[model samples]
Target: ATNPFTITKLDVNEKPRYSKEAFKTSTLQRDAYNYLGYSSTRTMMLAQYLYEGIDIKGETTGIITYMRTDVTRLSNEFVDAAMMHIQKNYGAQYLGKYQTTKDQNAQDAHEGIRPTNVLHTPEYVKANVDVSSIKDEKLFEDAMKLYARIYGRTLASLMAPAILEHTKVTFTSNHHDFNMKGVRLLFDGFLKVYEESKNKDVLLPKFHQGDTITMDAIVSIEKQTQPKPRYNEASMIKKLDELGIGRPSTYASIIKTLIERGYVTKEKNLQPTDQGILTSDELDKFFKDIINIDYTAEMESNLDKVSEGNYDKLSILKTFYEMFIPMIENAKVNMKKIQPVMLDETCPRCGSQLVIRKSKYGEFIACSGFPKCRYIKKEEAPTDS
Candidate 1:
């Protein structure tokens, strides 16, 4: 029997387990389609616009607070403003105080997502932008929804904790343990508008914790372990963040660099190709002293110190290049020769090796032999373009 299942952030490399019912089904293929095809990036970009700001209402107006944040802490001013708004607009009973406990290690420098101007309602701002501007309208709509979520959470934090009733059901067959859980919501609390995220319990007809359940059927299936999935943008960002290897602004650029250098491929998600693995391995091997983990960490620290005025900037760069020089020399002498990876499959005109060349159009393919071959490829636009 085939197993149907659902998982969240399950590392993208897990065997599907048999289950009678499931929700939020996801797979490597599904994520690849969503991200590799640019849908996920486009969606995030739209969300960022709403979170940041956009040219709407004849002025650049941002809806929610900054999107790129790990902080759960809200500003005191924002909290005060929200409480005032709730008291005036909603009611005293609807207001609840919440305190989101944050870990000391987390980077919570920025406040939680909030409205730039709580007074600006979605309908009020709608008249400011052109009716034909779908981009502005979409951005405005998303901003308004996120604003509501942040505002609602602020209110809910102060309210009494939501109460829940739960029951558990267990079924066993063929010496295998199977378990199921159900929950029932006792109060709506602050889950009025945020109902979609509310975990409504699956109310089971009265059953005790020790209740025995009869098995209707037993099913078994063969399964195979799958290899680790290639890194996708979001997961890669998370990984990079965890490693402390790069900053918020650098992760996207690093991934883009890997793609441009043929170190990685984006198809079926961002998989490090053979060349990528080889190149990374080679660099790490011969240039270990320059590019290894310790070097990177120390260099980052020095850069931080420089920014803080404790160290000179030029001296750091000089020290880096000075250390790198010997590594380059040693690699030139001892490293095995490797051919440069070419991106284009073939020359546009002569079917020769299409070596990449720098040009006004950024980068282009031309015959490797150049002048003697005298062949250049100009990009032509097709109807599909």
Candidate 2:
């Protein structure tokens, strides 16, 4: 706060928030419509297929470079390869230079999204893989097309930094600070391949610093702050990535696990279920130390220590078990009194009151007045028959 010498120059008139005036503002909604229709697992399967390889045009060809990467990196080899392909196929002008990013956190292990072999375009593949001629061929075609888009994005990323010539038109109407900032594309760069990603810029005729622009209309619109949106898969993964709580590979599994454990449910939005709330609350109350944030932090630290041979994993587990056993016993002794469960609903087939029962699989409702009623809600399959 005290270092003025190290301060960076700021654009005072810049709009901090995303503009609603743009044509393509609903990106999150669009992505949800695209990917979330099929379950996360199925989507991953198709993407993997596209990434691996596809048999098209009577020759085996790879659609995409690779999938399952969080890194926004492009190798020099890949860049060179792309440039070579572009020159050979399109033209010399299509070939672009490598892109530079200031983000030091970018993973450099994998190249940016590109076709494994650009010689095998989607059109070439479609010629052999007819839509109606074969089953699952259409699915392959769709995946291949998406792969082409990814490849285009990689190429565009390698192109020159898109320059935006910003112009601010200021009109002081009744001493109100009303200004409209506009931007025009200074250089199109890689947008030739992937123009959909870029937002259309508004072109202003021209303006000087002191020029008094005429007010077209005074439109005062009242705005209210929107409530935070429910976390989507992409945004959730991004947050997890930022917190360093989970790796890129584990992000999908974490979400999946949360669902499987009944910790959360994905309806129109992801929400914690009653079971999740109860479980978390009970655990927090009875096992405060174990459930606390510090405990998790310490556990991570200890795991790192164990990995480095500074601590023994078995010893840590043994110590934890020793402490936990007594707590379990204490909870069992001190916990609420047990009440016998009963089913209120009657058997659909028989007019008899249902009773609560247990089996190896779990618990269910069975007819208590069963001998005469001949009603049984089978909890589990009979082991023998």
Candidate 3:
């Protein structure tokens, strides 16, 4: 249904939009690894240190709530405290409504990540944690930054909706229709505390419905369709959450395992290594059932059921063993020994020829001279013409 129409009206609207649910959802979606392209496991470890009593000054006390959770449910006591803090600091108008809905798969035992005491702001923690002769100053700073993010998110979740004004202008040229949108923040509200939540505003000139304007220039740029992009650490973790492949508690570990096992390499995004591709092909040829995505997701579901006491854990293990043991035995005999691809270059450290070797870590260019020379370099991806 492609039809051209004249501009009927230039519309403008203003409304208040709540950010609590959005912040809660996005907090889970934003993985720590992807934020700085570092190890997610390290982020979790630091969060754990904050959660489990860190020595602040002389007394040891937890700085934040539990970090190993997918749930975004906040306890009433914490919510009330956060609301009161927001009202006291910002004003009465900034206090938001409390949220109650929880995800179906989310465990009810743990609360969403938040500061242990709203009164102890990130600034106070940073000042207290700072030591004169601190050996790991960077770690302490990073922990403080994370603490601030958690504090801001928690407080923002209990603040009022951000008010915005939106305007749309429609135009028609040669039976073709086009439109432009403009948005401006009318009130900061929760965004006053969570500065990261603000979107870039597009200011537009005032216009009437029937007003005509002359065009300065017209251009058409040539472009081609692009293939789907590869997944990054954050996107991959989000996908895992959607597919029920693993719990939030295990996401960091899963990523670490993939990197350690040489199954995936992180550059700007996660890319399968040469060894990884070969291993996958071999597994697909011999054990498609075991390596299947659906099967793995189903097993995760079964494990969850077992945890909930709906399924027998031993029975599930027995079923998996029955199917897997035979495959393992068969693969041991049939699987071919994969040889490394020898490269044209020589090792810089040693005079030996460089060979692309596959290890438990990943594929790398290593010196052929075994025990004597152990120099290695990361493999580079091929370039297009």
Q: How do the residues 194-308 of candidate 1 rate in per-residue lDDT, one tens digit apiece?
A: 3324234575554444444554554666899999887776567656655556543355567778777767777757888676787788888888777766667577667767767
Clash totals in order: 7, 0, 0
Compute the lDDT of residue 91 as modeled in candidate 3. Answer: 91
Cα lDDT tens digits, model 2, 325-346, are 8878877776543232666787
Best by TM-score: 3
Query: Is candidate 2 or 3 superior in lDDT?
Result: 3
Best by lDDT: 3
Candidate 1 vs 2: which has more lDDT? 2
Better of 1 and 2 by TM-score: 2
Which run of 10 residues does model 3 get worst, by summed lDDT? 22-31
lDDT of 2: 0.56
Kindly report which residue stretches of model 1 are placed more than 4 angstroms away from their true locations once superposed. Answer: 1-44, 51-59, 66-72, 83-113, 119-167, 171-178, 182-206, 209-218, 221-228, 333-365, 370-385
Order the numbered candidates by lDDT, best leading. Answer: 3, 2, 1
Alpha carbon lDDT of each predicted model? 0.54, 0.56, 0.74
TM-score leaderboard ranking: 3, 2, 1
